[model samples]
Every structure is written in structure tokens, then in C-alpha cells.
Target chain A: MTKTSTKPAPIRRDWIAKSLAGTLLGFTLAMGCSGLLILATAGLSPGTRAQFAMWLVTPIWLGVLSGCFFFSSGLRAWLWLGGANLLVFATLLLARPA
Target chain B: MRSDYIRIYKTVHTWTGILTGMALFIAFYAGALTVFKEPLARWAAAPVAALEVPLAETPALIAKTLAAHPGAAKGFQLNLKPTEDEPARLSWVEREEGQDDHDTLSGHHYSATLDAEGNALVSESQPSQLAEFIDILHRVVGLPFDTDPNRWLMGVVAALYALALVSGVIVLLPTLVKDFFALRLGKNLKRMWLDAHNVVGIISLPFHIVMAITAVVFAYHDGLYALQDKFLHNGRLANAFNQQRPAAKPAPRDPADMLPPVTLLERAQALSPGFEPSSLQYVNLAGPRAMVRVWGTDPAALAPRAMGGFVALDPWSGKVLSRDFLPGTQDAANTTLSSFFALHFATFGGTPVRWMYFLLALAGAWLFYSGNLLWIESRRKKQRQGEALPGQRLDTRLLASATVGVCIGCIAGISLTIAAAKWLHGHVADLNAWHWYVYYGVFFASLAWAFWRGAGRAVVPLLWLAALSTCSIPLTTLLAWAVPGLGMWANTSLAALGVDATALAGGFALMWAARATARRVRLGAEDSVWSARKILPSCQGLS
Candidate 1:
């Protein structure tokens, strides 16, 4: 096995901030995504749309939460996910049935 | 991935996995048994004289039963093939007042049959809840009750479990190819355990993913539906699943006019040739919106739910009201959704799939157990050759004790309670409450014993206890048959026999574990917490 550096890396974890951002922002992002899908599938039956909307949220929420750690910093994670949530929810609001 | 990202993910995997390992162990172990829940229920059920109400007589039976007990008009099930679990031709459960919708156990069970004189013989029944008790453990991670709080806790654990899976995959990605399927068993036990853990985790990644995702969905589907109702459906999502018919002055309908159970079965079978009808669930039979759900299995297709799929029918005209959940007849979107349930519940591809799930679930339980051992081993303190033996770290010792206590205690507790189902039937006033008492009693006692004796000292004895308790399941059956004086009874059905067979094998496995653990404790390295033998400096030279 090759020897590697034992010193600490030069990156910040920001665990608490990252977790908070991931949890709160990730949820909104998931809800927004599901809302968009529900609006897009308005032509389908209500039961089908409801099923899709309900089931699709968890995977998306978890995906965002998992990906949150990959962000360079917690602030960036919050900013990007917050922006995505805003855009998606705006589309949902605009396209939703009156 | 960057090396620092890999390092961060490794930390994530370790913390998430350690936090949920024992709870997930109990969940997976109980879940493995729950895959054969019907057989377990059958094994625990007291044998009764079979009620031979034929298919042709079900209509008359239903009418007479409804006439005698009008409350049953809300819902009643006509069992098509009466097994040891449901020996009666007709049975129904009435939920207690103010009971939660998800609570399946707190209900008044009643079964009806036609006597020799052709009259409805309705009797209140207390079917054994051993299987449902185990199922509750599986659903809520060893919690006694299936309440919202317990389910929400389970949801949190499942979320962490999913995170663990993803982070674990990422951590392994660095050496994914080099260590793929490598099981090097040698002096380095940590490496061996790690290899074993990786093999199971990687090979069964898809299975674990399905379990984690479905578990989260199952726990939080109600809240998800509420959110959807508010945002997506304009607060009307609940109305979608329930068929809406314009009410033209609601009136009570006669149960006598409803179509027979056989006709509903025939219609369901005609719709899907592979669908084998198990029961006819008559919902709201006296109401204008009466419907019968033909519940059954389709071996060739995915089931939408654990009790298999159903096709709602208008009982009056035998018209198919809804085919959305019908297994073989689902649309593409429905099939995709049903695949989740079917994959998690092992409801498709018949008996072979169920067996495969049972083994995979057991393997999953082992994966959690081995993960804990790996954590403990990685933290083991090594003693130098010339230096005096150093004390192990407090955290590792405590964690070792807890891991053994919770996991082994759960195994012994479930097995002993299963045996008690036969032993304590008529002797107890409320057998169901006694089931809880026995399980918690053994579980807490085992935990206490583990702490008092230390994990190394307690592990072998606990393994013996688990083995003896599991062996008692089959032994109870043997005594029931061989010794007629015993009040316990045994069913000769294949399902019940299968339960006995499986328990016997599990018992031997636990015995082997005890022997292996004893060997490790006595002969393994002295520095490890698993070692119980004390080496004195003076005696080392004398020996």
C-alpha cells in the first residue's frame, strides 16, 4: 500500500450548516419538484397524479440531501437548492389548474 | 470523486450506519420472518374443526350473517381457501371505537359459519396475534405499537438508512474494482469482516435501496398524501382514490341483493387469468355505494399491496368498478408504482420469490450485525509484545455490550415469544398482552444480563439462550404431537411444518454461533474486548 498524508485536509466541513441546509432546503426542493410533476401530469386521472406526486417526493428529497454534501460550502448548497425550489415552484404556480 | 469527498462520505456512512444498525437489525430479522407471516400465523393458530361452507352457500351465509349482525355490513371478508390461520369460511374484524386507521391489532375479530341445521353460527374469535406482533416489530423497528410516532421514528431511521447506503457506495467507489468479491480470511479479522460487509452490501445494494425507499414511503405516505392534497389536488386528493358516484338520496341497500362471492371471484379471474382470488372483501354492503374488492395474488405480475392486489366490483351488477390495483391488468404508471410494493413485499413471482426474500432479509440482518462487529473491530486497542496489557476503550466496550444486548436480545425475545404462543395459550387471561410481556421481559432481561456480565462473558450464554428458545418452537410442536396430554396443539399443514423446519435450522445456526464466539473469547487476541481470558505476567512464564 502507498503511504498518504496524515495531516488534515484544507477544506471546511460546516457539518451543522450543511445538514440544516440539506434538510430544510432539500424538502422544499422535493415538494417543488413533485408540484411541477403533478402540474405536468394534469391530463392524467387524479388518482394517478396523486400517486405520482406522493411517491416521487422521497427519492428527490433524499437525492438532494445526499448531493448537498458535495457542495463546496453549506451556503452554496442553500443558495443553489433555494434557487431551484423557487424556479420550480414558480413554474408549478403558473401552470397549475385554475 | 475527490479523496476528501470520499473521506467525508466514509464518516457519513459510519455515523449513519452505527446509529441505525441495531434497530435495523431487529427490523430486518423480524421482516424476514414477516415474509412468511401467514405461515407463522397458521403455525400459531389453534386447530379447529374446519367449517366446510362451500362456495355455493357463501351467498346464503353472507345474508344470514348480515341479518344477525348488522354492524358487519361495514366490512366482511369471505375466505375462499380456509387455511389453519382462517379456518372459518367467513370472518371480519371490527375496529374498536376511536382506534387509529393503521392499527390492525386492536380489533374485535368475528367469524361466521352455517351449522348443521343451516343457521348462521356467529362466534367472536381471538385469533393468535403472534404473526401480527412480529409484523409490528418489523414495521416500527421493534416498537410494541404501530402508532404515528413510532412510524415517524421509523421514517427517520429509514431516511438515515438511505443516506447510509448512498454514502457507503461512495466510500467503496475508491476501491470498488480491486476489492470486488474479495473475501480474504486470515489473521487480519478486520479486513475479513470488511470484505464480508462489502460483498453483501454491494451485491444487495438494489435490494437495500428498495427496502429503504419503500420503508420511507410506507411510514410517511399519509403525510405525503396530505401535502399532495393541499398543493397538487386542491385539497381533493382523497376523493380520487374513492370512486365518486352522485348520491341520489342515500338509502340502505339489502345485503341479500349483493352478488355472491363466487361471482366476484369469477369476474376477477376472468379479468386476469393468473389472478388467484383469496378473499372477497365486502365493503359497505348495506350502503348505496356498496362495493366488493376481490383480493388475490397474481404469480406472474407485481402486487400493488402486501395482501396482494384487488379489483373493486359493483356487487349488485358484478361490474368491474376499478382495475387500477389489479395485478396483471395495471397500466404502465400503475405497474411502475406497484413494482415498488411488490419488490418490497415479495408479492410477485409466487413462493420462490418469497423464499428468496426470506433469505435476503436474513442476509440483510447479518449485514447490520457484521457492520457493528466491523466498527468494534476497527476500534480495537492492540497490546504491544513487551508491554503490560492495556484496558480497552470505554466506548468500544459499551458499544460492544449494547450491540450484543440489543441484537441477541431481540433474537431470543422473538423466539421465546413464538414458543410461548403455544405454551401460554389457555393459561393466560389475555394471550396477546402476555405476548408483549414475554417479549419485553426477555429482551430487557437479556440486555441487563449483557451489561452485568460484559459482552464477552454474556455473548455465549445469550447465544445458547437464543438457540434454546428457537429450538423450543419445533420442540413445542413435537411435544404437542408425541405427548397427547399436553394442551398445546400442532397443525400438520405444510405452512406450519415449514415454520418448524425453519426454526430448527435457525436454532442450529445459533448454536454454532455460540461455539464460535466461545472459541473467540477464549483463544483470540488478549487485547481485544472480545477476549475474556486474563493473562498474568508471572503466570505467563510458568505456563
Candidate 2:
């Protein structure tokens, strides 16, 4: 009698990895849209623009914030990105015209 | 600590949803419609003259009325110049305190317009009936007979809405990332419902939060007034509260002997630079106290709340006394408030925003209904298998009834009341009373019907009724046009063709729902009644 091998299906690592990647992309898009809105509406000065640029990329600093919710091997990278973004927004809010 | 917090929030969300879901549904739905209040008003007052009267006309009209009936000129308001599709309406209220006889007229109230000779024109083109009714629905849920309890009750409901929103977010947090775009269809009712509820909730998260917060703010404005009195006013609650209160007694002003209305307008405009006059108010006509107050909008402003400015002018001297322009701080606050309104009304950026909000609002309404379905689907098998305790079955039924009653009830009530407005327009003794009668009458009738007919059967019929009522918007217009006094072609007509067009689009949607429901019923679906059919089959398979 031939024994039919019963093994657990693979974890579909690619799909999970893609989902994580997609989430990061979505986060980026959302941040980009928010930045565009600020530029279009906030009437920022040249100095303010430089400050905002630094803040815009700060989402990467809060890498821990993203991994706190989801379980992924690429969590550390997301955390770093998120941590950076938080730092950027904080700086922008604190920025004053010189 | 985190887990415990999440649990507490979950409980809060569930209880809040249970408590305020019905009221919030009505408020949000009615409010969404109210964003187009002007358009609705125009629709209600169809066939009116597309008059673009000068802002100066209001004071002139007020002067004419005061001259004609001097005793009736206690306090008057300029109805403002109507847009290209509306007629300017002028109205004044006269109050007589301490009248001896019960039958004695408290005060004379008169509204009139100017003729080609600038004489008083007596025509009854009151505010739009439908718009007023919708406003009432939005404000008080049409419960005039029980105002005190209703306000308090609605206030509680608003509080509960905040709780629900917070809890809903908490519940969503765990799966938000994995299921951000996950809309799984087919046979697992619980999963399907969860997906629907989550998708809608998350997609419209910003809108839902705004609605909840604003609803609480609006419904509990009385509380805010109290707070302002307590904290900001240094214990002078009454005085603080009264500051924002609209001027009640129209101070009798001595009308100037003779003054050029255009001059007053020009002076008022000059006082408020870059502001276009929206309305002009003349007080105490023919008396020395006669004054022209010009209300205008600032064009360069981003916020509509801060956009309005006021200039009060002395008709005789054309001297501007008060110029209330939006201050910087006030403008910022007003801008925030205005954004909230813009978000709520979908009028911030104009047409595209309005359409987006409309679709999202409808989706929100769907989310509320589907959330209840998810709860039921999760619990249904237990009841069917006899595994649920005795009270569980009753609980299930009650929830079912409530879900059906509130959702379908609101829809049918709004539709019937709107339709009835046309039927009862000129015949009713009091237009306002008739509006209330129709609204409450339909509401009660719907509640009773929901209870009598099982939720399953009631769903399709109520959907059809709602669809039919929405569909009737265009038909009502056509009927108005066909009827001699009610047609839209007349320059003085109050209804707008845009409203009719909206109704036609709404009708198509209703037809689509009816078809979907019929298909579900044919498929022998469980819980096909209160749940939307498009997602039902997939939900069933999941179960």
C-alpha cells in the first residue's frame, strides 16, 4: 500500500512578504499625500520648506511603531522607517521661522 | 496594561454601538442631506423667479413694510438676496408683551416684497417646505412633542457614538494591516460581515470620527454653553450664555426721514474691504433708529465659517458704526470649525468632494447595518442549533428587530415625509406642523411595520419604499411642472430642477437594491432580510 504523504502546506512566505511591502508602500503614499496637502495649503516659506523636507523623511525613524501591530520578519525595517517619519513630523511642528 | 485597555475599549465600543447606533444613523443620514440645504430649499421652492436683487433691496423692502404697517415693525430681518435660481424672501417678527386677552394678537407678523414701483408686494413665497422638514430631522429628529427628553436622549446617543467610534477603532487595530484591502466574498457570514464592517469603517475612518465628534459637539452645545459660562465667563454663566444668543428684542429704531439705500450699501461695503454683501437688514424703519446692517463674505478666506463679516450702517448719515471682521485667532478657530462642517457637508472643495462624501456617507450607513449583521451571523448558529440559552434566542430576535426597525425605518420615514410635503403643501393650516405630522407619522408607522412584519420580509419592502420615495424626487418635479401653481417654469417657483435630477439618480439606486434583494430571497439565503444581499451569499458561505 502506497502511503500518501501528508505534510503541512507552505506558509506562502512570498504573499506575506508582499503584504508587508504593500503596507510600507501605502504608508509612504499616505505620507506623500499629507506632505503635498501641507505644501499646497500651508503657505510655507523657503526655510520652512527645508525644515519640512527633513520632517517628511522622518517616518523612517519610528521603525518600532509599525512592528508593534503586525508580525513580520521585515518588521525592524518598518520600525526604522516609521521612527524616522515620527521624528520628521515632530520637527516640523516645532520648526519656527528664523 | 495594553491588553486591558483594549478590552475596555472593546466593551465601550460594543455598548456604545448598541446604545447610539440608531440615533447616529438618523443624524448622520439627515445631516448628509442637509449639506445641500440651499439646493433642497430651491427645489422645494421651485418655479420661483431667478431674481438677483441688489443687497440694498432688503432694507428698502423693510422700509416699505414698515411704512405700510408701522405697528408690525418691531424687529425685522432681511431674508437676503436669493441666488440666480431663488427669490428673495423678506420677513419681520413683531412681539407684544403682556397682552390682556388670550385671543388678542400677540404681535403682528408681516412679510412682503417690493413691486416694480418699489411698493410692497404681498406674495406668499415662504421658505422651502422640504428643506425645513429635513432641517428639523437633522436637528431634533422631528420630535417636537417631546423636545426636552429628545434633546437629552440625543445627547446621550451622541456620547455613545463617541464611545462606539473609539471602540471600533480598537477592534480594527489588530487586523487593520492584514485586511486593509481584504474584501473576501462567499459563504462565511461572520467573516464576510467582519470584512464589510471593517472595510467601510476604516475607509471612512476620518469622516466617521469627524461626524462623531461634531455630533457630540452639536448635540451637547447646551453643555458647551454651560462650560463656557462656568470656566470662561468667571461664574457669570447667564451673561456668558447670553452673549452668543441671537438678539431677541428688535430694538425699536427711529427711521431716518429719507436716505438713499444704495448709499447705505456702498458705505457698509466700504467699511468691510473685499467683502461682498450677502444680506442687508433694516431695523425700525421710518424711525430715527433705522439702521442698515450688511452681512458679507470675504473671498480670499479659506474657511466659510470665518468668511462672513458684518457692517452696520446708519441709513441717514451712511456712517458705518460696527465692522465685525474675523480676527486672526478667531479666523483660525473658525477655519477649524468650518473644515469640520466642510467635511460633514462635503462642500469644502466643491462638487468632487461632495460626491465623494455622499458615496462615503452611504457606505457609512451600510457599515452600521452590516455591523449588526456580523454580530447576528456570529451568534446565529448557536441559536439555530439550540445550543444558545433561552434568552439568547430572544436577544437575537430583539437585535434583529432593532436593526430592521432603525435602518429601514429612517429610510421610509424620510421618503414618506418628503412625498407627503407636496401632497399637503397648500392645504395644511400650518406648514411647520404639517411637516412634523408627516415626519413623525411616517416614523411611527415604519416602526410598527418593522415589528409586525418579520425583519426578513420587511427589509425588501422597506428598501423598495425608500427606493420609491427617492425615485419620486424627479416625478414630484414633473408633477409640479404639470400642476398649475406648483410648476418649476415660473419665475417665482421654489423648486429647483437639480433636486429632481438627484431624485432620479437615487431612484436608480433603489431599483438596483430591489433587484439584489429579490435575487437573495430566491436563493434561499438566511438572514437575507436586514443584511445587504450583494455581500450576503459570500457571508453565508463563510459560515
Candidate 3:
């Protein structure tokens, strides 16, 4: 006998979502790399430390969004992990001295 | 996404890849080698003492030469110092006013030994043909004719490459997550090939995109000019554009006796604070229309092709006529343009950056070749049984032929040309001519060979030819060394050594590949033997 299978439908890709994701990826990668390079060369200014910290968290956000596109059982775990990392990065960015 | 869109993208990708893969392969591969052009040039002309002449002395030399040979001074450029690989060379082209033609004069190169005050002591030498050949290969696919068609063709290819990249990403979307970092070594041929293709494509996606975009910018510079004229400058484009363009201004027609070289230099220095005079040109000094241009370099301006400032000085009164920095518009645009070219041409930062770019470029070439292989392998089983469509089969064959012909052809042609350079150095009229002859001859020969022999067999032989030709580099060097008065131990010797080293490595690789093929043939024979025995036993048991 054949077994009937049911799974959650793939997320509908709206224009807004796609545009947001693409923009996020581009901005994050550019800013993150740029910030890291600057920081490595000359330590970050106190005024810009928060902004740099926010930029660093962007990769995690991208990882979560990318995971959502697939149908692996471990995807939920990946999303959760990515979310937690983003939160920690954001907290650090906010807490940095001006 | 809609299936229709995916289908359209797939078609676009397929067509583009089929159309432009060959040319792109050659350009990228040769370009990679060009990153080490200086080293290769040095290797070609080895055993010469390293020398550097001061910037100030060059003006004196140029002025002296101009005074002696008025005919040769027209539109001349003096390269002041030699880099590690190249000896300091002076090149001038003379154009007589009444004549429409220009004659070039070279081989007045000088190497410097430092004096007690640490100034240059000058010595003369000839140009290196090997260096010239390598440059030609990088610039125009080593074609004999002008670069107009090649540039236009590359523009179209670059557009197609961009299309391919976009479509490839679309097709790969569904499997990307599962297969990211996946390399299935053991399995069906198609699967293995696909994995390899996917991994390389993803890893080097950024490089491929940059190459495609930069290629378009370089190849379609005319289009950019047209666009700028139409949009940026409005309908009065010509007038607006000309104002920014480098216009030749007529100098005063006074017979100002040649001013002191020191005074002219001082004036130029005063105008441009940081830059030292790199070269000086005196226009029509004897009769009328005399002007001096002192060209200099700005270390900070080395970020890209920002022509820092070339100051033109009135030699007689020490008046600064013009102080020009490469136009701001050009610099802003060239930030992207120059960086892209620098990245592609491997001229960004010094040796480390160039070496990195070289390795990346080679990887990019491999990526293209593997992509073709993956496509072919996907349809191989059907193709073998004649089940594939006629058009599809034709495309597959064509792509295969191109892959073998262009890549291997370039290697073989360039190597042969370099060898010919040494052999025909003094014998050839205009030593540069031998470069064209050898390159074109080998290129066409390879193409013909590819057409005659099927791609399957052509690959092995062509690869071997490439390997052999490369090995000749060392042999050429040895020959140069053995022959007395050949300038073998000179700076040009390094170029020969580099070629030999590269060739030997290539030869060994080809030999190893040939050995692997032999081993595969043996394995196939053994498989047949086992199959025959198994079939006979099965038939007997059934009876």
C-alpha cells in the first residue's frame, strides 16, 4: 500500500520578500566586509562601533532566509540558531560605547 | 517562479555558453598568464645587471637625443626606469609633417650604475621579443590583425557570459541548499560532473560576475562613450565632451633657444608639488612651436589609472602652460573601471595581489572547461546511442572542439612564438613580425587540426603539443646560453628560464594525464575479459 504524504508548502516568493532579501544580502556583505577591513587596519571609532556591530549580524539573517528556501528537517534548527546569533550581535552592537 | 521564466532563462544560458565559451576561455587563461608578464619578461632576458636611472637624468638624455636627431623627437616617450624584469627602454615614433606615415625607433635602452652621489650611470641594450609576445597574447588573443573585431566580439561574449551567470543561478536555486559543498566523487558520470560544476560555479561566482562586467566595460567602451554623449551631455554632447577631452593646443611659434633642462624641470616641479618629472618632451625646438611637457607619477594616484598631473612648461620663460590631472569624471568612472581592469589584468597591488589574481584566473578557466564537460556528460549516454537530437549533438561536438582548440591552441601558439622569437631574433625584419607569424601559424594550424580530428582524440594530442611546446622554453634558454654573443646571460635570459620552468611543469602534467589514459584502457580490457567469462557461465547454467 502507498502512503499518503503531507508537508508544509514552500514559502510564496513575493516581490517585496525577494527585493528585501537581495538588498539585505548586498548591503550586509558590502558593509560587513568593509567594516571588518577598516577595523582590522585601524580600530573602530567609538561613534561608529554600534553601526559596525549591526552590520556584523547581517550574515546570520541571510543564513536564516536562505534556510527557509529549502525542505530539510534540520532547517528549523538552522533558523533558530541563526536568529539567536543575530540577537546576540544586535545586543552587542547596541551595548557598544559611543 | 514560473516554469516559463525558468525555461527562457535556461535557453538563454545554453545559447550564451555555446556561443562565447571558447573566446572567454582563451581571454581569461591568457590574461592569467599576463599577470606574471614582468616576471616572464625578466626570465626571457636574464643575466643582465639590475639598473635604475634617476628621473632627472632622463630629461637630459631625451633632450640630448632630440638635439641630435630632430626627426626622431616627434611624439616620443621616454621610459625612465626599468622594473625588476624589464630593462630601461626608450621608444620614439617620428612623424614628418608632409608625410602621413609614422616611423618607430627603438633599442636605445639604457641600464644604470649608481655614481658616488647615487645617480644613474647609463648603458644601452636591445628589447625583449618574448615580453612583447606575451603582451600581444593578453591584449588581443594573439591575432595578427587589429583589435577592433576582437574587442567587439569580446563585448558580445561578455554580455552572453552575464546572461549565463544569471540563468545558471536560477536553475541552481532548487538544489543549491542540499548540494552546497557537495562533491559526489563516486557515482554516475553525470552526477559526478554536475557536482564538480556546481561547486566551482558557486565558489567563484563573484569572480565570474566581475570578469563579465569588466569585460563588457572594456570591450564596449565606444558604447559607453555614446551613452555618455547622448544622456549625460544632452544633445550638445560634442561641445560639452570636447571641453573635457585632451585637446592639443598650438604652442607659440617663437624660436626660443632650448632652455636649460634644469630650469624646465624646476618649473614643472613648482607647478606640481609632490610629483617628480618622469618624462620630458620638446616639440619643434629648432625652428618654431617649442613646448616642454614634464610627466610625473603620484604614488597615491596609483589607486587606479588616475593620470595624476602632467604639467606643460614653457621652456624659455619657465611659465606653466597647463597643469592637468586626469579629469575628475574619468577618475570617478575609472574607480570601477580601473579596479575591474586591474583585477582582471592583475595590476592592482604588487606581487601578492597579482599572484592571487593569477591563481583565481586559472581557477575561472577551469570552471568554464568543467561547465562544458558537465553539460556534455549529462547527455553522453544518449549521444553514444544516437538518441540525442542532431542540433544538440552538433552543439556538444562544437563546444568540445572549441574547448580543445582555443585553450590548447593558445598555449601551443604562444609557446611556439616565444621559441621563434629566440630563433629568428636578428634574422627577422622587425623582430616583432616573427611573433605575429608564429602565433597566427600555430593558431590556424590548431583550428584546422581540431576540424579534421574529432574532439575526443584531438584533446590528447593537442595537450601533448602544448606540453612539448612549453618545454622548449628551457631548451631555447640553453641554446641562447651556449651561443656566444647571444645575450643569453643578460636580463632577457630570465624570460627564457621562466618559459622553460612553466613548460616543464606543463609537460609533466600532460605525460601524467597520458599515463592515466593508458591505465584506463587497461582497465577497460580487463572489464571485457570478466564480462565474457560471466556470460558463458550463465548460459551454461541455464541450459
Candidate number achieving the greatest lDDT relative to the actual structure = 1
Candidate 3 structure quality by residue, lDDT tens digits, B1-543: 655445545655666676666666677677777777666666655345554555555555554555445554344544544544444534454444554121122334443344456443554555565665565455544444326576667665675677677777877877789999998986465687778877877888887877776666566555544543353223443553223232565554333244656677677666545555555655545434345666655443432332233566666776665453321222343344345445555544445676687778777777777777676655542313322222335656666667677777887887777677566766767667767778778877887787667465566677778777877766777776688577444234444455567667766876676556444333322111101122232333321
Poorest 10 consecutive residues by lDDT, candidate 1 chain B: B534-543
* Error in Å for residue B250 of model 1: 4.7
Error of 3 at B21 (Å): 0.8
lDDT of candidates 1 onward, in order: 0.89, 0.56, 0.55
Instruction: Using TM-score, rank the candidates from best to worst.
Output: 1, 2, 3
lDDT of 3: 0.55
Fnat per model, in the order shown: 0.68, 0.00, 0.00
Q: What's the CA RMSD for each of the models?
A: 3.5, 12.6, 12.5
Rank candidates, lDDT, best first: 1, 2, 3
Candidate 2 on A1-98: residue-level lDDT in tens?
Answer: 23346763222223334335434543453344344434454454332332233233223212222222332234443454455557645554455222
